[model samples]
Target chain A: MTSGITRRVRVLLWAARAGAADHSAVFTWKTWLFGWFVRMLAQVLFFATAGNLLGPGQARYLLVGNAVLMVALHGLFATASTTWELENGTLPLLVASPSSPSLVLTGRSLFWLPDGVACGLGAFLLLGPVVHLPIGLSAVALVTCLLVLVGLTTYALGLFLGSLVLTATDLRNVVSNAALVVMMALSGVEVPASAVGPVLGRIGAALPLTHGLLAIRRVLDGRGGGQVALLAAQEALVGACWLAAAVAVLTLRARRSRRDGAALFLT
Target chain B: MSLLAAAGRFQGQLVLTHRDYLIDLVRTPLLAAVFLLLVRHSGQPQLIAYGLVAPVLMAVWSMAMLISGEVVDSDRQLGTLELVIAAPVDFARLVVSRVWVTTTISLLTVVEVFAVSVLGFGITPEVDHPVVLVLGLLATAAATAGAAGLMAALFVATRTARTFQNTLSYPFLLLGGVFVPLDRLPAWTHPLGRLIYLSWSADLLRAALAPAPVAGAAWRICVILGLGLLAALVGRLVLGRVVRMVRETGTVGLR
Candidate 1:
């Protein structure tokens, strides 16, 4: 059992490296930077311009919200990696592998943590001077922590959704796009969640980014560190729950697929 | 079957087989809900109208560009590009037909957005100039299809068609003034915005829908129609050249 655990760990790391390399191979440096930096700048500018029309304070709020939301977008897009396996006709091979499917799915999304962190950091650094975000050393440290938490939470959610791809291959874009729209709507990314209906507000509370966003706003407002720490812990707990749920769901589905001989078919 | 019938059948197949097209159909309502919920506190009829119309225009633009951009790649992927190219048909017509079908399907968003504005927000968009509004919608649809044709031409020759297709989404949204006025953008971007037909379309739309008569409505409409014609012409020329080049190189389905 110990050896088996070690082998799974090795497979997880190996799959992570392969996933990262596959992602990197899709773009040249120019395209990557253009997709990441330029596109992000455009999104920020668009929201900032729109926010300006709403109110004076809205631009700052939207700038920060969208910057943080970029981390979630990275995580959301990472969930589509399983669609690549389906497209390449390798999903069956993956299902047939002796390694645990849950671990493999977890590993496949492991790179999204660093990718989301980089995107979050890039959005912050690039937009800070332009949007005049309060970026002192303490704010930076707090935001960094927030970014890490947001990354882990979103990546865990991505792994959860990625496992669903095993059952429905065509759900990749629908899941990603719908998640983005819903998250942006409910998570106070564009507007305060409180302004939304009570039902959506409660839904936002359960989401990972909501507390992290509230904490980021507090940090910017020069609130005490205890609040930020509490929110960060809440966000981490949410992420851990999502990761555990994903593993459980994937294990159940994989076992059923193996028994029913449905693992090889696209259905 | 006639070319138009064939295209219709193809679109029907897409609707049945591909969930993306179905998602595209509902995108405007989803976006409308998001935008309306965000600005529900404002309770301004004009703001709600702007929010409603913006997503309708975005839906049109996205559907047009996606259908146009993916046609060549989809054909290649399905191993039918060479057969299609070898057939005695005008490739540009085929592409234009597909884009028109997409544009028609996307027009459903216009109704959905309007309904959201009325039912959800209790705001009815004022269309003071009904004639001008109708004319503007037609011009916008034509211009969008034309732009998609041009993008389709560009996608046919590029190896990284999907990346390029994805990259066009935000730039067009930002520059076209779908959600914000072009004047709000930087001075340098105004000229670039003017170059896109959607900017002119948006101008015409706002002028038609505003409570008071806005100036330059005629000029904007004219410019949009002219740009649509120019784009379709350029797309035809470019697509012809690219197809010929592909034929010469025998690389129709290579990408």
Candidate 2:
């Protein structure tokens, strides 16, 4: 009998394979270049506008905020793309494979790490024209850690939403879209949460974006990675909650589908 | 030759289409409510702050149209394209009618936003220039219709247009002066904003309603309307040719 570690590795390998398959259709180098070109152009344009509008230091802060925001968007929305697959009747096949659903989703999201990191660096590079911030390896480490937490939480949310497709009638896409748009608006990425009112401020304070942004803000202001501990803890707690929720919902949906003989909808 | 008969036919179609659009728009009040709450939360809870909601709401409207376009695409894929094309009506007229219906629905959605602002946020439109306001709204409606049509055509052509639509639509949301002032855009994006119908429409509305009178608000409205009409024409031409080709060739098994 294989040990648990070996078995887990096998599952991870299979999950990676599944993730690779999802993008096989659109994974051309041209597509990657197109995506990068568009994103980089937009980022440059955004930075130029911000630099002209704000003081140099403030522009640097805004860029840091946008960097953290890019991580949040790439991580969270990448997971949601998996939910779209599930809702479209392609997720069941992946889940039925040797790989677990969570592993599969993780692998799929991790595939975007290269793109996210590249674009983030591109955005950070533009920051030099705006301000002279003390960005070092420690700031990088903090952003990376915060990104991990964001990815984990977002993956869990995606799984929970995907599981609902088993019995949902029509509102899945609407719910997903609404959730994403609301998250983007409330994340305090573009605008300060404090400017938005008490209710929105409270909501923003509870979000991972707020914590990650605060961490980056401090780092850009000369504080090192030490400030990330509080944010990491909150993100860990939120990730745990969402992960547990995803497991419960996925199991319930899978069990129901099996009982109803509707497992065909999974793939 | 009777005017009543012609008017009856067109009016009947218009009313029915408007009713369908209304039903769809009203089905999701929660999102609209969230937008209202977002504006209130943005710490700019004055009646003039209603302008802040324009960008996001317009984006939402675009998404709604995209979703509906996907539905239409699915129908086309299922061999229903020919049925619509074969109907005893001009293709351009049909497309325009559908867009008109959708634009009316978006207008109603804005009305709902205003109502929510008045009730929930305690804001009121100054209504200094009623003519400008009405014209501005109509211009905005026209612009939205054009954008929707363009997206519909794009989606109809490519199966994977959703992601492109999603990523590309935000420019209008951000650069169109809906949430922020247009002057805030960097020099580069400022000119591009002119290319976007939303920017022109938003500028017209803002000029009409904001405390100060904007120079050439009427001209901006005309330019926006012209762009909108041009977009609508292009959309019709592209979608019609594609649909006709699909019908003749049965390409990709679509009717």
Let me know the TM-score candidate 2 reaches against the reference structure: 0.78
DockQ (CA atoms), all models: 0.58, 0.18
Query: What tens digits encode model 1's per-residue C-alpha lDDT throughout B11-54?
Result: 65775587766666656777888777756654444566567667
Clashes of each: 0, 3
For candidate 2, what is the DockQ? 0.18
Worst 10 residues of 2 chain A by lDDT: A47-56
Candidate number achieving the greatest DockQ relative to the actual structure: 1
Show model 2 residue runs off by greater than 4 Å.
A35-63, A78-80, A84-121, A126-138, A165-170, A184-187, A190-206, A259-267, B1-53, B64-72, B154-163, B188-190, B243-255
**Candidate 1 at B122: error in angstroms?**
3.1
| lDDT per residue (tens digit) for residues A1-267 in model 1 | 999889988999988887888878876777767765577667767777777766667778888888888888877775687556666776677779987867776787566677667767777787777667758887888788888888778777777777777556677777777777778888888888878889989988877788888888888888957988898888888888888977897788777778888885343
TM-score per model over all chains: 0.94, 0.78
Candidate 2: CAPRI quality band: incorrect
Model 1 regions more than 4 Å off: A1-5, A265-267, B42-45, B160-162
